[model samples]
Target: MSFRQGAPWPIPPTATGKVQMKNGYHQVKYTWPAAGWRYEARWHERTPWARLITYPSWRLDRTRPGKGYGPDAAPRLTETWVGDHWLPVSRLRYAAARYNHGCATSTDIELLKAAHPAAKQKKLPGK
Candidate 1:
């Protein structure tokens, strides 16, 4: 699917080992190349009380030579996880938000189970 500005993060439908829970937040980090660009993303989420907050940051670098290249080559864009106030709503974040509101679908519940195993047993907000 297209990962546009308003679209969800590229979370695979199947289970993956990349998912994790750290410091009270669910996280997924990976890198991949697409259409001649290399991308690295660090996505994480936390549901404190009743709200789900997500930080999806990434950096994209040009892998192939292009006309837009200047004398000094550098990444096209870079966004770190820290100092992010404009939180965008990604697919993963949307799913977490739904779960927090007690309107989770099967896929959303499955994601929660994978990201936070404790959620399977406890009545957690992200679960």
Candidate 2:
């Protein structure tokens, strides 16, 4: 999905932000000086059962100077909503993929399929 240039929330004075609304969530990103880059996906709407079991937001913060460095050099902090609390994530990409797939509505899947009819449907992690 293509991202728009701004976010719904107030961006910090020093940070630049962008947002993409897809599947039932708002995928937001912010880049600043020392903090590096931050990514988050917040649910826009949820079903009754989903509200009971899943957290409304998930985040990934990639520290500056650590982007090209190995995992040990930079801290790639990630958090996932698990019911009542945020759970720390060790596997960053996997956690983000899981959030994307889990938050995708049936309509979103159908739209993707329609747009890429010839492409193979790859199952997302934890799907």
Candidate 3:
């Protein structure tokens, strides 16, 4: 931990946590590397996107799918969830445009179940 002489606050250490949320057909876990930093926003994962990867974490997952990648841009899943619906897994970039609008959360699934009638009852993982 580090603190500034004049400031009353201490700089918190980097912490990590995992978040798994599902809305529509999208389900994935995001790892947060720093403490006290939680992503707060709305989120949608569109179909037809590709896997996204975050380095240092070196984790890989599918949200959509990407065609190619370079050194500077770490590989990331193509996102597709959007506006209370699940599209067929073929729309490129899925709903990449909307991701900047919000982050996803566990409660969104509750909202989705309230809106859509056919959502599969999810079983607890590892049960």
TM-score of each: 0.29, 0.31, 0.17
Report the Cα lDDT for residue 122, model 2: 24
Among these predicted structures, which one has the highest TM-score? Answer: 2
Compared with the true structure, what per-residue lDDT tens digits does model 2 show for residues 1-127? 2222122233456566555565654444555544453544332222234422243332323333335475667555554333334445444334434547687555544432222112111211233
Model number with the top lDDT:
1
Arrange candidates, best TM-score first: 2, 1, 3
For candidate 1, list the clashing residue pairs, or say none.
8-91, 9-91
Pick the winner on TM-score between candidates 1 and 2: 2
lDDT of 2: 0.38
* Per-model CA lDDT versus the true structure: 0.41, 0.38, 0.29
Cα lDDT tens digits for candidate 1, 2-99: 22221123433331225567766565545566666444444444444324322332321123324557687654443222122222225446667788
lDDT of 1: 0.41
Question: In model 3, which regions exceed 4 Å deviation?
Answer: 1-69, 84-106, 114-127
Candidate 2 vs 3: which has more TM-score:
2
Report the lDDT tens digits of candidate 3 across residue range 78-117. Answer: 3223344433323323233233245534344333332222
Note the clash tally of each candidate. Answer: 2, 0, 21
Model 2 ranges with Cα > 4 A deviation = 1-11, 35-55, 58-60, 66-127
Residue 18 error for model 2, in Å? 1.1
Model 1 TM-score relative to the real fold: 0.29
